[model samples]
Target chain A: AQTVTQSQPEMSVQEAETVTLSCTYDTSENNYYLFWYKQPPSRQMILVIRQEAYKQQNATENRFSVNFQKAAKSFSLKISDSQLGDTAMYFCAFMSGTSYGKLTFGQGTILTVHP
Target chain B: EPEVTQTPSHQVTQMGQEVILRCVPISNHLYFYWYRQILGQKVEFLVSFYNNEISEKSEIFDDQFSVERPDGSNFTLKIRSTKLEDSAMYFCASSADRGRATEAFFGQGTRLTVV
Candidate 1:
């Protein structure tokens, strides 16, 4: 069984600054994918960024990027030029390449972007 | 962009009553899934459906929980006898395929409240 862990229960960042949410997972599989999802007050879960475990280069999507360290089993999400809209509960997820796309998510971290 | 749609954004029901949550996945998607998140807990996988049958399921998906693709467009999750612990936000997601890189698109969750 794969388990994702988000150590930080809560985090805050000033507007226009940057914030990084840490995530770690335990999986024996060599091929997998990691993702960061944002859940706003509306209860809509949105994809922030994703990283393939086989890729050495990190994945970047506009202001959202991931620091993926496969050896350390760590995949952290970084949000640059953070805005108030970034405030939400962020969850880290893991999906094995052979598991047929089933996702295992972390407990989540409450992030607040203060103006 | 294609998106998944769920009906009855919010549902309130008495304990022991039956509740059905409905979702319409993307037109071209081939995989469907159901997940639930308690108010302060991680998003837990319930079941995954493919080819009109269940391909995978978690421990949380007990005998009380059942899924059906009754028609061409609708995917439904039914809780035969709801309990207080069953109150949570239920999410419906779909992926284009079971390939290694496909992303699952999620719908705005349906909040279920069992009192």
Candidate 2:
């Protein structure tokens, strides 16, 4: 069994600032995938960024990047130059390489970007 | 970009009634999945379907729940007898393959309100 944890239940960031959301997971599988998803008020779940466990380098997508420490079982999402549109519920997810499309998600963090 | 489509953005049903959520995955996707998120909770995996059959499911997916790919493009999740606890936002996702690098795209969730 695998579990993803987001310790922060709520977070706030000033507009144009940077914010980091923490995530940790417990998985026995050596090869797996980590993802961050954003759900806005519309309830649309959008993929923010993804990191492969085998890749030592972190994943970056425009303003969204990740700090993945495989040894520590930590994968945190960093949003740079955050904007009001970045306000949403963020979730950390895990999927085993061999588990097909089964994704286990964390409790999610409610992020507010204040102007 | 190709996107997964789900019908009836919101559904309200009485307890003990049957409810069906429908989805149309990406044209090239080979894997389909169903997940649910109770209000203010983590997104939980329900089932994954491949080749018209379920490949994986979670403990939350009990006998009352069933998944089907009745047609070439549509994937469906049915709750035979819904309970109040079953009220949640149901999401449909699809992926091209079962690889560590591939990512799953989620649809705009359908909010199921069981009263």
Candidate 3:
């Protein structure tokens, strides 16, 4: 069984500043996928970014980038130039490459971006 | 820019009653899934459906829970007997392929309140 952990329960960042959310997972599978998802008050789950375990290079999507350390079983998200719209609950998820695409998610971290 | 869409943003049902959550996945997607998040808890995988049958399911998906692709475009999760603990946000997701091969798009969740 794979388990994703997000140690930070709550985070705050000033608008235009950068913030990093930490995530770690325990998985025996060598081939897997890691993802970060955002959920606003409307309860919509939006994909932030994803990283393949085999990729040495991190994944970056505009202001959202990931630091994936396969050896350490760590995958963190860095939000650069954070805006008020970035305030949301963030979840870290794990998925085995060979399975039916079921995702194991961590307890979400609620983020607040203030002006 | 295709996305998954779920119906009835909120549902309120009495204990022992039945509730059905519906989703319309992306037209081209081949894999579908259902997940739930209890308030203040991690998101948990419920079931995954492919080729018109359930490909995988978690232990949490007991006999009381069922999934169906009754038509060409609609996927549904049915709870035979709702319990207070069943109150949570249910999410529907879909992808073109497996976890390592593609990204899964999620729909806005349905909040189920069991009374």
For model 3, name the residue pairs that clash: none
Error of 2 at B22 (Å): 0.9
lDDT of 1 by residue, B1-115 (tens): 7789999999999999999999999998999999999998889999999999999999999999999999879999999999999999999999998657678889998999999
Clash total of candidate 1:
0
TM-score of each: 0.96, 0.96, 0.96
Candidate 3, CAPRI quality class derived from DockQ: medium
lDDT by residue (A4-77, candidate 1, tens digit) is 99999999999999999999999999999898999897766888888888899999999999899888999999
After superposition, which runs of candidate 1 have C-alpha atoms over 4 Å from their true positions? Answer: none
Q: What is the lDDT of candidate 3?
A: 0.93
Model 3 per-residue lDDT tens digits across residues B1-115? 7889999899999999999999999999999999998988889999999999999999999999999998979999999999999999999999999766377889998999999
Candidate 2 displacement at residue A49 in angstroms: 1.0
Give the C-alpha lDDT of model 2. Answer: 0.93
Instruction: Quote the positional error of residue B75 for candidate 2 in Å.
Output: 0.8
Clashing pairs in 1: none
Q: Give TM-score, chain B, model 3.
A: 0.98
lDDT of 2 at A37: 90
